[model samples]
Target: MSTRVLVQQLQSLPDGPVTVSGWVETVRDQKKVQFVILRDETGAVQLVNPATRPPAEPVDPSTGSRTAEPQDAAADPAERAKRDEALALTDTISTLTTGTFLTVTGQLKHDERVKLGGVEIKVASLDVAAAALPETPIAADSAMDKRMDWRFLDLRQRRNNLIFRVQTTLEHAMRTWWIERDYIEIHSPKLMSSASESNAELFALEYFGEQTAYLAQSPQFFKQMAQSAGFGKIFEIGDVYRADPSFTSRHATEFTSVDAEISWIDSHEDVARMQEELLSFAIGAVAAKHGAEIEELFGVAVSAPTVPFPRIPLAEARDIVAARGYDIPRTDGDLDPEGERQISAHVKETYGHEFVFITDYPHEIRAFYHMRDDETGLTKSYDLLYNGVEITTGAQREHRVDILMEQAKQKGLDPEHLQFYFDFFRYGVPPHGGFGMGLARVLMLMLGESSIREVTYLFRGPTRLAP
Candidate 1:
């Protein structure tokens, strides 16, 4: 009747009667004793029950002879009741399948011999909450596709559960760090009248008759609008939609974006400094909170990156990769995946850092809103690559409407279509800059995961969308 005791909490508590509820992980039905491993979100624990046989006929206390049996005989009521209850519990536990939900009220005992946490519960009563199907469609070694098909089952693994926990800790830490610094949290609208970034990969939907609306590719426009609105500093952690058809390990059609915009920034270097400090604080929180569990489950030590992540110019990065014998085959003056990897390798070897900010990207590859350097003609932009994967794109924004419009025209983008965005600049807007970071991509790189799909709760791609 009392609140259920969590499996993880049992270790620190004194041994006594307690009730625990969770799904059955494994059942070992034996002739003498039955054992069931019950698992909740916290952890797993062992439950034991001794077998009981049918009771013998009861003797009448007064006559010293066998009592006459009725349809619902209660002869030797106390003994019969105890025996029947044990039989029911033994049978119930034996019938339990993996993933069955149940509650156990029992005497909690700490036994050193028990392999699982050195503790066990002796069941006094068992209540079956829900019975799962006997045969599971997936297994420990199931193929990734099949595992994804049954993600509900796949997530039942403790390691998968730990992934979301670590993610929660990481996000919370970042929010706390930002809030303490007077950053306003904003929830930018996902539905938009126009694209915020490039128009190449917009998800268009028909609004009222003949009117088309598109999912906002990023919070770029509104985030910058926050700067114009004089909010000073703002942060948004929200979902963004993309129609990118690339079937790469790092590509997802929909993903969580971590964005931040600040007013009165000197240049893109200031933005890069804030981002590196943010990552150091956030990743350090993750490592401190879940380091042991991650190492146990993932076999990879969580690295809390130091501040001042190495910065390299995009042009220099390309040359470094080229010098490393890997020429980027792109004409846009951007580093390809292999090139990013080479630069990351060089950074690891030279600076001993896992994160590198590739700065001063060419205007041809960056968004039109990015501020162009007066002398260099390159955009004051940067891409933060984590372990060879690009996790973020950041830049200083051009506040002058005239230059922004001209840049838009130069990029072959219609200035009229972005008039609403330009309006933010037309007003008295301070110099500002921001970044859009992929949350799953960060987790993928931190955990050494091969794909973003592994960290995404429900991956969306060009072809796959369902339960």
Candidate 2:
């Protein structure tokens, strides 16, 4: 018979036979009917069975999807003992562990009392796909690190569930926006011979034996390389690695980076327009697809930011935030985490918007490639702030090779090592600009999630190395 999903079986007739496959969420057995809440990747459906076994049914070995597997009730003495042990193992999973897998063939019953999905499957036949042990390694009340230990179970929560869905919707919208604009989507290699921005804090690895390679901290250089190669405009959403040991809710060892670059920009203003448009697209798409569910699960309202997100110079924002009595504690001109929060709050209070672009960062604070706005003595850079966290860093690049080399030297980097990168600006490179944002950071803050780990699937963090 063809495979069918449990959710599709909801409208099935009560007497009609149906098949359901999913991890066992819970099993409630009384005197007559036994019930198991089955969950798959999509959602949950309940499967009900009779407490008393019916006539003999053949065990299907194909769908070992359950955490519990049946044993030979009749066998030789030695084999039966092993079988008994297997049955005991399966029986142990009747306790509450949500990650156990099961596949149940059952009848359909639409019951009003059903707490999930408003329908239940009367399990006429069943199979144990896979069984998790009775005890789970992590608790819902566990710390973020602990929950990350059992991230598979940790993601089973409805709030964490909505986070990824919202991410999908937001990314889908961004892709659609880019495609509509005829923007070529690109994937840049994560290994580079030279630092795209700087060399420090790079995760380096051995290349053969003669040379060294570093994992990309961002797709910035390759995207700029595209601009040098005459790709008018481009965007990339991919993983970026950073070796910085930032112990914060927002920091991750590896992150999904959303990046873009374009040629012939009027200034960083052109880049800012695209940023606002793309962000608005993402927010609007998420709100349309899952707004009500987000409100139900995350308890936060999502809205597409209106065009022209409030843009204030970094110095202006610093002064404004300082006036509010929360001085940025950083010695550098860059905003700290607390400063980001306060500035976001300041923007919310002043412009009534959740997003703000703090532009014109001090040259010493921003990367060397950012163009210097001579009038202001600040780089043509901006940090896109969302809901009190910095989600993106963008700027108009220093296309002048001489100035770029000078900037690199001033930052204490060897200019000769960056020969190929500087060579891009030596010839026919356009006046270009772009931005790179962390995808999960945007989603986490958008859904009001406390950490990026909650949104990223199989997150790689400082101490998290395995599934």
Candidate 3:
């Protein structure tokens, strides 16, 4: 038996007999012919079976034969082989069900009429394989929650298919950019000895017998430790858990964080430039490789943003939104979700761009470690916005032990509680700053996907805990 060739593998094969296998995406049942749209991760293709009505076998009215009459033995193998292949296909279609898994060996035909990539396979034989229950749990038109309940079915859509491809392309571009710049890529421990920044969002669980352990919320302090330890510039793309339960499209209890920090940077502006370059490479890669597919699937055109994405001072952004008739409905010196939307809309209309950075956030809302600007009483901080969603929060951090301690105290946070994290500053460290961006949210916004779950491989949310 030949190995199971994936649908994607068909593209490289010479036009000849080949075997392909995958779950049936569509079943076009016809009296004189049948077709199955089969899909695997790489691509989708059409499987053609020139078979008479299957199962309740069709009668050959002229000959009154229930079975297909045998092709003449003296006929040429090419024509006879085609006849025999079609007959075998007829029988194979007799037992197929919508979600059945199967392997097929057949002649690959490059035909323009077949809509699936303008290709088709004439079946010689196929294994009926595992058939699914007739009543599908969820249909394409099903509601989001119901479709999520049957996620495997929901992922079959081509739009969902292109999302991850774009993700892979983006990640690759980032990795290449990091490698070329000689930045160390590190994977910090998910289970930590102490909180990286604070206990507010940590997932604490009992440790071996006596003490307790916690899941790291961000690689903040540890990445800083590496800065102290003199790795110079380092980055990590890893998962972090949060205990907060704010149910929003952008909030996830657990999520992949894209983090990076560099020593000897002048300020957060330095960090902001690196971030702009990183995302620029990512969006550019996606535009070059998957832009057309993204348009076909998502109904939106994408472009790799040029360097220096629009930057707006928080105060100026406030004035812009306020002038535009939308007051930020909060007192935190920050924009609310609606305000974010309004500001983003203004950026698009004013600058013709999809991303913007709102910078110099007020010190009060930032973490205790964020470096405070004496001139303005604000932190050297920024949030990168895509379409109107906050995807990253970054700032220059206080490296002075005494000032860091004072800031922690002023925040009503306990010094005794954050002893471990504070120690990074106690030891000698370079002036450094970086950003933590949400992985799925970036992909979600980049592809214009409506929900985080749509782009997440296996979404984890307040209610979703299982496959």
- TM-scores across all candidates? 0.95, 0.87, 0.91
CA lDDT of each prediction against the hidden true structure: 0.91, 0.81, 0.84
* Candidate 3 similarity to native, TM-score: 0.91
Better of 2 and 3 by TM-score: 3
Measured on C-alpha atoms, candidate 1 has an lDDT of 0.91
Candidate 3, poorest ten consecutive residues by summed lDDT = 49-58
Q: lDDT tens string, model 3, 1-467?
A: 98777777777777888888888777887877788887777787888876643235558898988877554653888976666666666866765777777888889987777777767898777886788777788888898888888887888777777777888888889988988999999998888866666667778888997888899888888888898898999999889988877788888888889999988988899999999998888788889998888888788788978878899999999999999898677977789998898999999998988889999888788888899998988899999999999999988888999999999899888788788877787779999999999989988888787789778877777788878
Task: Decide which is better by TM-score, 1 or 3.
Answer: 1
The local lDDT score (0 to 100) that residue 344 gets in candidate 2 is 91
- Evaluated at residue 97, the lDDT of candidate 1 is 94
lDDT head-to-head 1 vs 3, winner: 1
Which 10-residue window in model 2 sums to the lowest lDDT? Answer: 87-96
What local lDDT score does residue 148 receive in model 2, on the 0 to 100 scale? 77
Model 2 clash tally? 12
Best by TM-score: 1
